[model samples]
Target: MKGKIIFFSVFFLLTTGAISAQAKNAPRSIISTTALIRKYHDQKELSGMQKGELLELYIERIKVLVKTLPYIALVTKPGVTMADLGIPDDSEHKKSLENQALGTSTFLDTTVDFQRKMMPYSDKANLIAAILFYEGTLKSLHEFNELNEM
Candidate 1:
């Protein structure tokens, strides 16, 4: 009985700590487009905050969009496909998108890691690069919204 109790307690603690860390990393919420526009005066809300915060938000959304892609596929109506989202149904286009996503992910990680190490420094170069990556994420989101009619 004592061993079982200790084992369960350790398991619970580890999982709880992991969950907290995950939540902390996920700073951006899936807020309505209206709220985002109201606050940021734009659809993407990419430049709403200072350099560090903006980078974090962009990274969060990029990861969410990629992760949400599978969910989008599952919920999309039958017979509708990537071609409907203005993407071609071929390897060349698919590979292009994959490359874009990879670049976004890399940019996100590089910015985020740097910002974490040096917070509150809104360097122009970092902001410019972040904005560029953000544009791709915004375009993808617009396509997703168009697909879902949201």
Candidate 2:
């Protein structure tokens, strides 16, 4: 009985410690686009490295968004084919998109790893602003495409 009691106590302590550690290391929540824009306006001029990081984030996000173009068309427009979105129905195009997705996935992994390493406050605002800008641009493009189709 004493052995079983000691084992449970040890397990409980280990689990609690692990939980607390994970809580401490949890990723920060994503800030809103509005807040990011506000912060971006207040930021000082970015250094070359910061500009490079921002550009990388923007390009990676655009690649991912492009990968979703076909699916977005299918859902938003009934009976729409890939050709309607100017996406080739051939295997080569499919393979190219798949390859792009894999590359984008790798870029995202490295980005998340960097963020986990505690990126600088200045870099974070620039990164977030780039993300918001690209996302908004894609949204606007999608809307424009829809209007043109009508």
Best by lDDT: 2
Off by over 4 Å in 2: 1-90, 118-120, 123-135
* Candidate 2 lDDT for residue 102: 68
Candidate 2, residue 78: the lDDT equals 29
lDDT of 2 by residue, 74-128 (tens): 4333244446556656777656645655665686577656654544444566676
Show where candidate 1 strays beyond 4 Å: 1-81, 120-150
| Each prediction's whole-model lDDT (CA) | 0.53, 0.54
Taking all chains together, each candidate's TM-score versus the true structure is 0.32, 0.34
